[model samples]
Target: MLPQHADPIVAIATAPGRGAVGIVRVSGKGLAPFVRALIGREPRPREATYGPWRAADGQAIDHGLSLWFPAPHSYTGEDVLELQGHGGPVVLQLLLARCLEVAQTALPGLRLARAGEFTERAFLNDKLDLAQAEAVADLIDASTEAAARSAARSLAGAFSQRVHALRDALIHLRMLVEATLDFPEEEIDFLQKADAEGQLQRLRSALAQLQAEARQGALLRDGLQVVIAGQPNAGKSSLLNALAGAELAIVTPIAGTTRDVVQQTIQIEGVPLHVTDTAGLRDSPEVDEVERIGIERAWQRIHGADAVLFLHDLTRWREPRYRVGDANILRGLPEGVPVLHVWNKVDQAGDELPRGDSDIVLSAKHGTGLDALRQRLLQLAGWQSGSEGLFMARERHLRALARVGEHLEQAQGLLTRAADQLDLLAEELRLAQHALGEITGEFTADDLLGVIFSRFCIGK
Candidate 1:
C-alpha cells in the first residue's frame, strides 16, 4: 500500500455538466471534524441530514442533503461524507472549492482524489480484489446491455470467486505432493493412494471450463473488429449503412465516393460488432495521393481486424479485370484472419438469392438477405447463442489463465516422466498457483495497479 492512501481525498463525484443533482464526496480517516466544519454538526452515521453547507465564514454555500459514513462501513473503509446539491457546474465547483478551503485548516493534508483513486483505496483496504476493481471501470464503460450485465457479474465477484476456488484446489494438491516428498521412505505409494492423478485431472477440467467462460467474457468486453474491403463501388458504404441502420457512411453511385475509413458499432443478438468500412481495394496508376493514403490505411485496419468481410459485386463478378483485382486483394490480406465472402447487388443482377453453405449473398442497397449477413458475422465472431451467466473479463485475465494452463500442462508432463522429478512437479504447481493468484491480485506489483486504475475516470 502507498502512503497516499492515508491522506484525506475529496472530489466532485458526479459527472461534469448540469443534471438533477451533483455530489461532492470526501473520504479519509476521522472525517468528523471536517463534517462538523461543513455542516456545522456531526450528522448521524449512515443517514442523510438536511442542512446548509457553509463556507469558512459560516455563509451558506448550498442547501443539500449530507450523509456521513463512519470508518470501516464506507466505500473506502474510511469515514466518508457526501454532499448532494444542485447539479449546475458552477454550483458543484463552488461546493468543491469550499470543501478544499475548509479542509486546509480543519483537516490538513486533504487533497483532490486522482482518477480511480477511490476504488484503488477500496482495493488497498481489502474491500475489493484487483479483478473486481477493474470490473467497476468496465461496468461504467460498457457499450452494450450484455456487456453491462457481464461487467456487473464480474463486479459482484463472480470471476474472482472462480479464481479463488481454483487457487484453493491447487493449494490442496500442492499440500498432498509436498507431504509425499517428506515421507519418501514409506512404502505404499502415498500419491497413488491419495488419488492425486484423479485430483489433477479434475483440476484440469475445471480450468478448461473457466477458460472458456473467460474467453466469452472477453469477447463481450472487447467485441469483434470487422473490416470491409473490396474493389471500388462494391457497395461497401451501402453495406455499412445497412448494418448500422444509419447513414454512417456516404453512399454514392460514384466509384470513389468513400475515400476514407468509416466506422460503426452495431449489436447482433447482444454481441457488439465494431465494423469499419474502408476505401475500396484496387490497382490503379490514375489514383490520386489522397486515395492512395486511404487505401494504405484500409490495409492497416484490415491487418488488425478480427474478421474481414470481403464484398464481391455480383453485377461485375464476371468481368475478367474485376476478377483479377478481387483475387489480388484477397491474396494480400493478412494470413490467419477469418474472411467472409459476401456477394452484393443480387437485385441488380436479376439473380436468385443463392442458397447454400458457402458465402453470404445480399443486396445492401435493397436490404435483401441482410439477416443472413448478420448471422454470418455473428458466426464468424464465435459467439455462442444464449450465453447466460457470463462475466466480463479483460485480455490480462485471459493471459493469466493461459499461463496457469501452461504450467499445469508442464506439471502433467513431468509427472509422466519420472517419480524422481517430484521437485519439478512441485515447482510447476507453485507457478500455476502464482499465475492464478495474479488474476485476483494475491500476487501483483504496484506498477500494474497504476496502469489498471489510470484508465478509469476521475472520482471513480
Candidate 2:
C-alpha cells in the first residue's frame, strides 16, 4: 500500500471550466471518511452512487454520481473517491473546496494535491513502474494520434519489457563471465577457447538495434527543431507561414520586415516540426536594439537546430559573401544534421532554378516544393516516408543509451588490448548494464524521479 498514513490529496481530474462533466478525485486513507462525510457512508467499489454531495451544514453542493475504489486496488494503491458533477468552473471549484474542508475536519492531515504528487505516489507505491508513470504524462500531453498510441504501448510495458529482456540477456552473459573471474587460474585458457568475443559481438549488435529504436522514439517525443537561415527576403518567413498554415510571421517585400524571430510547431505526416523564421541575415544601419537581439537569438537557433534550411535565393546564388560573418556557419554545419540548399521563387526564375545537382527548388509563396523539403527533413531524422512503428521516448533514454555505447567502445578497447585486461572488460560490461537499467528506472535516484514526474500535470 502507499503511504496513506499521510493526508489525502484532492484535485479536479477533468479539464477546468464548463463542460458536460467534472470529476474531483481524492486519494489516500482519508478517502473513506471524506466520502462518508459527503454522502453518508461510502458507496460500493466501482459502482455509481446517485446522491447530492452535501456541505458541512448538510446543504447540497451539487447532485452528482460518485464512485469509491477501496484500498490497495485503487490507482494509487490506496482508497480513492471520485465525485462526478456538472462541469461549471465555479461549481467544480466549490466542490473541490468543500472536499478539502470536509477532509480537514473529518480526517486529519488532508491537503490539496501538488502538481504531480498523485502520480508520484502511485509510482512510489508500485501501482505503476517508472515507464508507465511517464506514459501517463505522455498520453495527457500527446499532440498527435501516433504519439498517443506510442505512449500507450509504453504504458503497457512494451518498451520496459524490451529493456528488461536485454538486461536479462546481459545478466546471463555476466554470470558466465563472472564465474570465470572467480577462478583466475583457469580463466586465461577458458576465455581464449570460449566464444567470448563472439558473444560480445552479438550483445553489441542487439544493443545497437535497441539504441536505434529508442532514438526514433525520442524523436517522436521531442520532434525536430528546424531553423531557416539565409540572406534578406529569401522567402524564409514565407516558408514559415506555408508550413504552419498560418501567418505566423509577417512577410513583406521590404528587406527587414521581420525584426524578431518567429516560431511555429506543425505536424508533417505525424512528425512534429518546430520551424523557426528569423530576420534576414544582413548588416544594416536601421538594425536597432530589438532587431540586434533578434539576430543574436537567430544565430543561437541556427547553432542548436536539428536541421538548417539555408534559403539561397535562386536569382542570387553567389559565392559566400558577408565578410564579417563566420564562413564556417554555412560551410561546417554538423555532419549528420542536413542543411538544404533551398532555391526559392522558382516560378520567377523559370526553368533555370539555380544550377548544380545538389540544390532543391521551391516557391514558398506558391507552395511549390514544400513536400520535397519535408521529405528531406524526414530523411535526416532517419524516418522513412510512409513508414510505421514509430515510438515515443525522452532525452533521458537517449543519454542512457549513449552511455551504453560508450561502455561498448571501452569494452572493445579492453578486448583488443595487448595485455588482455579481463578485469577492465568486465568493469565495462557492468557499466553498460547499469546504464541500460536507468531507462526502466531500475537505478534512478529520487531527485531524478521528482524532476521527471513534476513535468506532468496533476491527477495523472
RMSD of each: 1.5, 3.2
lDDT of each: 0.90, 0.78
Across 155-243, the per-residue lDDT of candidate 1 in tens digits comes to 99999999999999999989888987888887777678878788888889999999999988999889999999999999999999999
- The 10-residue segment with the lowest total lDDT in model 2: 319-328
User: Could you tell me which 10 consecutive residues in candidate 1 have the lowest summed lDDT?
Assistant: 349-358
Candidate 2, residue 76: how far the Cα is off, in Å: 1.6
Work out the TM-score per prediction.
0.97, 0.90
Off by over 4 Å in 1: 350-356
Residue 94 lDDT (model 2):
88
**Model 2 bad stretches (over 4 Å):** 1-6, 183-195, 286-290, 318-337, 350-356, 412-422
TM-score of 2: 0.90
**Cα-lDDT of candidate 1:** 0.90
lDDT of 2 at 24: 90
lDDT for 164 (candidate 1) = 92
